[model samples]
Target: MQYDIEADWHLLNTCNYRCGYCFFTADTLGDKLQMHASPQQWQSAFDATDFTWLLHMTGGEPSIYPLFAELCEALTKRHFISMNSNLSRPLQSFVERVDPSRVSFINAGFHFEERERRSGNAVFLENARLLQSKGFPLLVSIVATPSALARFEEAADILAQAGIVPIPKILRGSYNGQRFPEAYTEPDRDRFRKFAALAQESYREMLNTSGHPSIDMFGDIHLLYGEPSFTGQLCEAGRRFVNIGPKGDVIRCGGPTVYGNVLAGTFKRAKRAKPCNTGGCIYFCQKYTSGPSGPQETRSGFFDWVADVIGTAKHPV
Candidate 1:
């Protein structure tokens, strides 16, 4: 059977930090990225359809868009809006202005390299604590790397000590066109899973442990000690969800803009076109589509699918 439809419309390509692993990394968004979507296009897209359960507003960084608040106000008028932000902005002002209930929760991604090297970690932590204290629903997203696991736990500890509860969303490592898998040797995955299990015990206990609400945006959230299990049908992106790029480009999936532009037509028609860069789709999305079946083939069932894409940054270009 087919599935419910959701749309992830990429509002702009403006971001404050140029993260290494981001799909719309500086290098990637370098040429095509722009803040240029007409009001007519917005209304047409909004009026032309009905299955937009979640209208995700993303950017190089949504806060920097200047008109983010206006966009949020516009979309919330029609759909349940979720703005994917790095939580690096003092958005309390912005949130208060928009539809509070329509705003799902902010996905706070702590850019460690930037925080440590560029903007001191102390300030970063303080910003996070401030958001948590305000009682804004939030999801903490961290990238998975050799040192990532330990750093994540440390960050969690710091947040807890500050009296903040955060849900950890672990993402696979994607860098300069490469992807990292959770093979047996990665001790970090094991440590994380144990931590997650502890968080599941109770809500209050989870504040100290992992229970903030862990989600894996990619298939590697959990490590399969033996063989991985596959469930649900392979994702046919356009049918399930669609992402409209900044310049009116409608991509089949978030992997890479590899299809028609909805501004030129509707999602139903966009699906008929082919992805412009299908071969180079990031690993997080590429593995699901037509690949060899095996014990390693990861599952994209209802549970796993949404978690993998919901708050994830675009794969690094």
Candidate 2:
């Protein structure tokens, strides 16, 4: 199901877990949940655009959003959906209600150390396996912080019980007062490379056919070596990709250019790709823009399969 545009929709701030590495801390993701509109309203708003959208449902945790299953059901009726979730919500409703074909993929974050502290891995495992059984394109990953990498093997063994391995998601930004991918030690890097290779092999069939996971494991693996700069380049962000805030405020990529509110049915889209000056989500930069060097993603066979599956960073994004 190829789409005209892909939106990184920030659904809500409500979350169930408090992982130390999360950009949103416990205080930021507090207990209060907000639902801006009903499923039908959201569906109508997108319909008003007269565009077939591929919405990347994101949040502090999207599954925790009120009537999440209904939202997925309604949105996928005309548009497509991919999700980023913690696998903490009960998916019985989602699995039964939403169509697997309409779903591009699901990137389930397996927060190991946090789950261990709160004893949530069992539920995580159950949910992860359940989705796989339903034929949803799924990728389970662990953010490769020092503690998670140390505990990777044990976590991998646990996931192996369900016939899947958690990929090493490179830790970015700041953690424990240290900026990462760079903060990693030689031993840490070796371990990350090893697991990444194993995970790539484990998910070979999926990657080869469906697409790269919502979190690009290969791009992340490369980031462990060096950070690529794509500050100014010709990008398709505004035209083919956009960032949507929780209220449906549409911003081109992560830039300040307002495309109007999607929920308000006032979006004005770009007709063609343009040069981007902003910086955020390099996956989009690496994908939507063309450049000479740095983060050269070989879009052969499997990666070409990615274009068919999720398209470009129109947010693995």
Candidate 3:
């Protein structure tokens, strides 16, 4: 049998912005002020992994971590790294140290709510442009909230002017009794389609045939409006992808159960994919881990694996 391993590490939960729709709010992340892992802790835990790992580092804004540059430099030496950030922090040090070739990609979230403060939209675009100019692959994404949807075209134009394609992401929370991606009013659906068209012509085509209740290489899909569910499917989560919390507790594909500590290196791998007992998992971890994989018939399967990563890099959520 052949397989691949990917891990999403929540390195910190301290963000500079308080976007109203953020899912990882203070209530969600208990003791949020105290939730951070030192660079040494992360380096040690990462170095313990024996596999050629595809590491996705996320946080309440990973760019704000004190040792962000040092951590990135160390991790890139051993594993492929991808980061999710709000792009509010400095980048020159990162550009100078970490090799762009070792980074799979960076997904920068454009928070419309915070545009008036700090360096604002201009700075965000400049930072993204700088990274791209340095040969780093980056994707700019924005939450499609009602207010943001109102200004989606403007944001897309700015990114386009800077040679960046803006990916309009479905807001994960609910609005006026409607859950997003799973449920949206026809007007809202039409708006999202328009937003996609503004970004790229191909995105319009993707929005059409991509079926209801489908999980593509991009993300979860329901019809223009429908319920999302994953209660009974067999998921290759713990076996293929896992979530490592800041303290190193490992959760299987964002499932509720904690298997063990990856920092201590005590979790065991299954020989085959396992059925997911967790009901209704629609998070990114579940979507990617349980999606599709080509035949892994060759030694290492490096080419196929890299292709998969590249495919995902194009559709950063």
Question: Which of the numbered candidates is closest to the native, going by highest TM-score?
Answer: 2
Q: RMSD, model 1, all Cα superposed? A: 8.1
**Model 3 steric clash pairs:** none
Q: Which stretches in model 1 have alpha-carbon errors above 4 Å? A: 1-4, 29-33, 38-44, 120-135, 165-179, 182-184, 198-220, 223-236, 254-317
lDDT of 1 at 180: 46
- Superposition TM-score, candidate 3 onto the true structure: 0.78
Compared with the true structure, what per-residue lDDT tens digits does model 3 show for residues 144-171? 7777777877777777767766666776
lDDT score at residue 142, model 2, on the 0-100 scale: 91
Tens-digit lDDT track for model 2 on 27-139?
87884898889999999999899999999988799998989999999999999999899998789999999999999889899888888888887888899889989998888
> What shift in Å separates residue 116 of candidate 1 from its native position after superposition?
0.9
Scored against the true structure, residue 306 in model 1 reaches a CA lDDT of: 38
Cα-lDDT of candidate 2: 0.80
Candidate 2 residue runs with Cα over 4 Å from true position: 291-317
Task: Return the TM-score for each candidate structure.
Answer: 0.66, 0.90, 0.78
- Candidate 3 overall Cα lDDT vs. reference? 0.63
Off by over 4 Å in 3: 1-3, 26-40, 117-119, 176-178, 200-223, 279-317
Model 2 earns a TM-score of 0.90
